[model samples]
Target: MASKVIQALYNDDDVLMHAVKKVRAEHHHIEEVYTPFPVHGLDKAMGLADTRIAITSFLYGCLGLTVAVVMMNYIMIEDWPQDIGGKPSFSYLENMPAFVPIMFELTVFFAAHLMVITFYLRSRMWPFKKAENPDKRTTDDHFLMEIGLHDNENELADLLWETGAVEVKVTEKES
Candidate 1:
């Protein structure tokens, strides 16, 4: 369904940031923001909570380390022995020096790859997914803020204009 929204366009990031803060100060809900580049402290200005992706990344790294250890122990120590430098230890701890590089590589690999996947999924982005940007100009040098339209359409537009928005208009958004 289509919903009414107030689209505020700003030519500068600073203006957009101030407009966001003003809109929020008035207790207006911000539906979305489209910016050409990342705005510093925008999440805080939007009153969003801190993300927990770092925790997931740490877990992924741990999993990778476990997989590497198990695979190496079964392969080089139990299944088929490898005598590096003509010395056969037959113990994972003894052969740990040689396994350090593999362990480190796997840990970083899992953390990086899994974090990327998690980010994509969490952001609702995937292969062949359509873009959600409301305006094409947002990809360039403009910032657009979409505020859901309530009974205060004119009030919001006036407030946004006062906050230095270059343009403000009401439009129907696809929900």
Candidate 2:
């Protein structure tokens, strides 16, 4: 089905934030917002749920730690024991101090890389993906708010303008 939507553009993040609040206060549903940079508090203002990336990051870190421990244990204890600085590779527990830095580095590396990959996958963003922003200006300096139409295009446009939108246009979109 085809639906009409209003795209409102704003010059400043502060104005966009206020406009979002005003629009939500009137009980209108917002489709999406595009900004050149991250707008702090915009997620809450848009009523989006909290993200679960932190939990995934912790899981990734644990996986990295496990890999590092198993790898070090096999290489140092069972495969080929080496003596460095008069310290013998007899047991993992006894020589754990030397492995602390490696464990920490692996944990951080896994968490950072995996979290980025997870974010990209969860957001449906990938290499060579087509751009979705309707206005090119939004990628540069402007902020855009899209609201689905319920046959009140004029009212919504006026409200957007009053709430500090620089430009408002109604367009039909296919779902």
Per-model TM against the reference: 0.95, 0.93
Where does model 1 exceed 4 Å of error? none
lDDT of 2 by residue, 1-175 (tens): 9888999999999999999999999999999999999999999999999999999999999999999999999999899999988887898998999999999999999999999999999999999999899899998999999999897988888999999999999888778
- The segments of candidate 2 whose C-alpha lies over 4 angstroms from its true place after superposition are none
Model 1 TM-score relative to the real fold: 0.95
Sum up the clashes in candidate 1: 0
lDDT tens digits, residues 49-150, model 1?
A: 999999999999999999999999999999989777975657789889888999999999999999999999999999999888988999999999999987
Top candidate (TM-score): 1
Q: After superposition, how far is residue 174 of candidate 2 from its true place, in Å?
A: 4.3
Give the number of the best model, judged by lDDT. 2
Instruction: Give the Å shift of residue 24 in candidate 2.
Output: 0.6
Candidate models: Cα lDDT each = 0.92, 0.95
How many Å off is the CA of 89 in candidate 2? 1.7
